[model samples]
Target: MKNDKADFIPIFDGHSLAGWHPVPRLPVSRAPGEPSPDPDDERYRRAMQTTGKWTVEHGAITGRQDPPGCGYGGYLLSDGVYGDFELLFEARPDWPADTGILVRASSLGSQGFQILLDHRRSGNIGGIYGNGIGGFHGINFTLDAKYDEHGRPIGLRLEDPAAAIEPMTPDKPALLDDAATGEQFLSRWKWDDWNEFRIRVEGASPRITVHINDGKISEIDTEALKHPLYNAAAVRDLLGPKGHIAFEIHDNDPGMGEARWGANAACRWRNIRIREL
Candidate 1:
């Protein structure tokens, strides 16, 4: 038996997908009976650059998204580039998925630092966004799962998990805080199964720290960032020392137009490993 985790390493090799690739759809925002983008449609940018379907069967590493819900799509990169690390994985959502887990990722200027594997109903898996900069700036506390209009999740699990801070831009207007770490991540999350996604990231204006199922929640530190464009020579290579290691299939991009999930949702990873600290 190889229960793994001996200094982490196995970045998904249960079957295939090699080092991973495909990531070309982030123009999200067309709901209300969707369907618009036709900028000389190269077949809708090759079907939104093949938005979804990164298979690998039983061992894990699935994505799904496609014609199941509606907006935003493509994602699944990671060819190499890491800095201070500590990732761990085991996410598992079936339909209402809006996934996340990209640290330092660039994929040739896509941006990263997300760690939210949204599970729908005002999702926020572990919160820590910052994609391509601009007030998408990080920190979310989450835990509000209690949907029911057409979103689902109504199994119930909310003691109060709603916190947002978005500091550099996105038109401002998102600032709520109630910390209690939302009942400690709903008593170590597990709504509908597998859960255990740890993160770490170290210095150079990057302190991040999240955990789920293992509890913890949020701990960012981007050099005491608060937003107003927390400078550092304007996002120094995304506060870099290294990058790459993504996995988010969250199309409908309008640059985080809220709602966060519930379209064709899909997320599943198995024993993904990492450890560079």
Candidate 2:
């Protein structure tokens, strides 16, 4: 069920990022965005001049890789921590944008439970992922480009998920309880328009249910999970009972022949509301 707007709290002000901060979500021991000291270091050249930040544009929270095609990625996390709640938002991404929502995210940017919105080639949107808690994926089919004669993406076609998944998420998530077919999702999602998402996350051992345009799409229950690498106890210890809500600006791994996020393309969000349960 949707939360009552009268009782809901606004997560975004619609004018500014008051309680949110951008963090470089890197998979490394070193601090994210810490430029290499030596000029000779290869990582030094990759240091972003002005990438990995979110901004308000035309009354929406917009996220993108800055300077057109720079190699950078990060998360925009809320300041407060929430235990269980229903989150409401609308997303309208460019033809090729790699973005997602995070619940129970760590402020340090390491761990989180993600609702996948990989809107590029060979990607899937209505899936779930264990970010740093455990590297797992939960999606049956991926999406491929369906372009018009103008060489612009018009819609998405379903494909085998094997080629698109990230390297980290090789196994199924600790618990992938329920999901809709890829064909069903494509039929429901409105292309080049805002799609409302209502997410309900509840229980100490959370059961996250995602609804797009008020239609149920997927569910994940981490309770009684038996996956080898996914330890529920360890994850809870790291993130605690309460954690921040975050958003992802996924990397454009140029070296690996991946253009997941289009150059300077943005994912737009609006009407972010939360109702703590």
Candidate 3:
């Protein structure tokens, strides 16, 4: 049966990070036109020192971006790579927090789609993001739109380019139980409680599906990825067929900056499991 329990396997033991590792830091550029810093930069070392903050507590893996100890946040990458699979998990986020799970990620930078766990008025839960590749600015809420072979968004473009910094807006939520629109889904997301999340990915063209709290949210097929949708050329070359799974701790704002999340803006995950399809 589709609802059978044995189809899935636990990836997080609820007590230890036995199969996960902190992602290596990528080179950062201090300013435009300046050469990017080496991977061995001091910032990378400082970031690694903070991995201890990602702790397994009360049967949940919790990440806290506390400054002075760890502020430049990064991803907690899985030691293994995955292709076609369904991942089931739950997350509780502090208001004004930004986090996501990266699928098919490469070590250099997150290379696949990031299911957005953004929890702020300007953010969208269950949004699809092309991490290191594609033109979507990582907050694509419209799902039915199709792209051309060149990656240009052709059929329907739902959102304007995301603002450099998401503006503070009043919290007026809409029902998401049977959400008819992305805005509804965003509104229905539980901000103060744990919410269920799921993702499924498959095929060479890479079709992705996202669900939040058991409500169907977003879906995308990347076969039509084209220019304007992201740098199609760079995506084709950098994005691989399969890679690791990782969780993000977005450092800066616009999404969920350290300032917004505060010194201890926390994001918690539990019941993390995946099943190959």
TM-score, each model? 0.29, 0.86, 0.74
Score candidate 1 by TM-score against the native: 0.29
Better of 1 and 3 by TM-score: 3
lDDT of 1 by residue, 106-168 (tens): 663246567776665445667676665533434344434576899665653642423432222
Give the per-residue Cα lDDT of candidate 1 at 180: 27
Tens digit of lDDT per residue, candidate 3, span 24-72?
4343332223355565776666656544257898898887664522456
Worst 10 residues of 3 by lDDT: 170-179
lDDT of 3: 0.63
Q: What is the C-alpha lDDT of each candidate?
A: 0.63, 0.76, 0.63
Candidate 1 displacement at residue 35 in angstroms: 39
Pairs clashing in candidate 2? Answer: none
